[model samples]
Target: MKLACIENIRRQKQHVERYKRQLARHRSGEDISLKSQKTFRKPKQEKHLKSFQVYKDVLFDEFLDKSKKLQKLTNQILKVLSQVWESPK
Candidate 1:
């Protein structure tokens, strides 16, 4: 269970990192696709960008909360296991 939680946290971290990279790229205009002949570039909207930023912030906050919970659970489990192991059979 601890390993699974650790793996989940790692995956979430990677996902958030990937999202951040994509957002940065989009912000820098690196995500614009060029048309063959007719070029139609959509103007960046501040509203949409602000919403995306907010979404990313929310995701990050959720990730942090889950990780903290997992850490607390892990510590509790370790403490219990250590106590059990040290007791006489």
Candidate 2:
């Protein structure tokens, strides 16, 4: 009987400690949520904007490269046409 009583007390103490820890966690979670409410969207939008700008820059660079290649191909074709015109068949 004495041993059972001692075990019950130990279990009660553990339960109380667990309850305190849970309450502490809940309080900290509230603080974090409050802080996030004020600052979350700004950082998220900034990150999205930054990524979008980078994507636009990449697309522009690709367009420039393709245009340059097309110009080179056009020049080569013009050169070939000029040669053919100058030479007798």
Candidate 3:
């Protein structure tokens, strides 16, 4: 029983020493722990609807132009191949 009581006192003393050190650090303004810091998140602003629509339309027109050019080139190549195939070997 005495051994158990001594062990409890030792544990309590260690805890007290840890608490005192933390208190002293706090009083000196040196306790910079992540768990004690406050974090703030800035709010996000919405995009301008008209400007976004104009940008999207411009990008889409560019994409369509590129696709049309690619298709025309492919068709021309196919036509050339077909003529070569029809001609005598």
Candidate 4:
């Protein structure tokens, strides 16, 4: 009976130590994974930001072109109106 009790205690100790080591390994592995994730995301974030700026530039150029076209059309209409008004009998 005493030997059985002693063996049970030993088994419990071994189990606790094994669990502790496994927990530590899991924590360290998580830290390594997070560090690598940050390293990987940094460059992707910069590239996304860079592309956003390029997209903004292209959108601005399109808006500017359309604005100039509208301005030109307005000027042509005003010139035609002026010519019609000046042709008095």
Q: Which numbered prediction scores highest in lDDT against the true structure?
A: 2
Candidate 2 has its poorest 10 consecutive residues by lDDT at 30-39
User: Distance (Å) between predicted and true CA of 34, model 2?
Assistant: 39
Listed per model in order, the count of residue pairs whose N, CA or C atoms clash below 3 Å is: 0, 0, 0, 0
- Clashing residue pairs for model 2: none
**Candidate 3: residue 34 lDDT (0-100):** 61
Ranking, lDDT, top scorer first: 2, 4, 1, 3
On the 0 to 100 scale, the lDDT of residue 44 in model 2 is: 79
Q: Write the per-residue lDDT of candidate 2 for residues 22-43, one digit (tens) a residue.
A: 6787888644445435855666
Model 4, CA-based lDDT: 0.82
* Candidate scoring better on lDDT of 2 and 3: 2
Expressed as tens digits, the lDDT of each residue in 1-89 for candidate 1 is 99999999999999999778767877997854333224644557977898898887677778999999999999999999999999999
Clashes, model 1: 0
Q: Cα lDDT of all candidates, in order? A: 0.82, 0.83, 0.81, 0.82
Summing lDDT over every window of 10 consecutive residues in candidate 1, give the lowest-scoring window: 32-41
Candidate 3 lowest-lDDT run of ten: 38-47
Q: Estimate each model's TM-score.
A: 0.36, 0.35, 0.36, 0.34
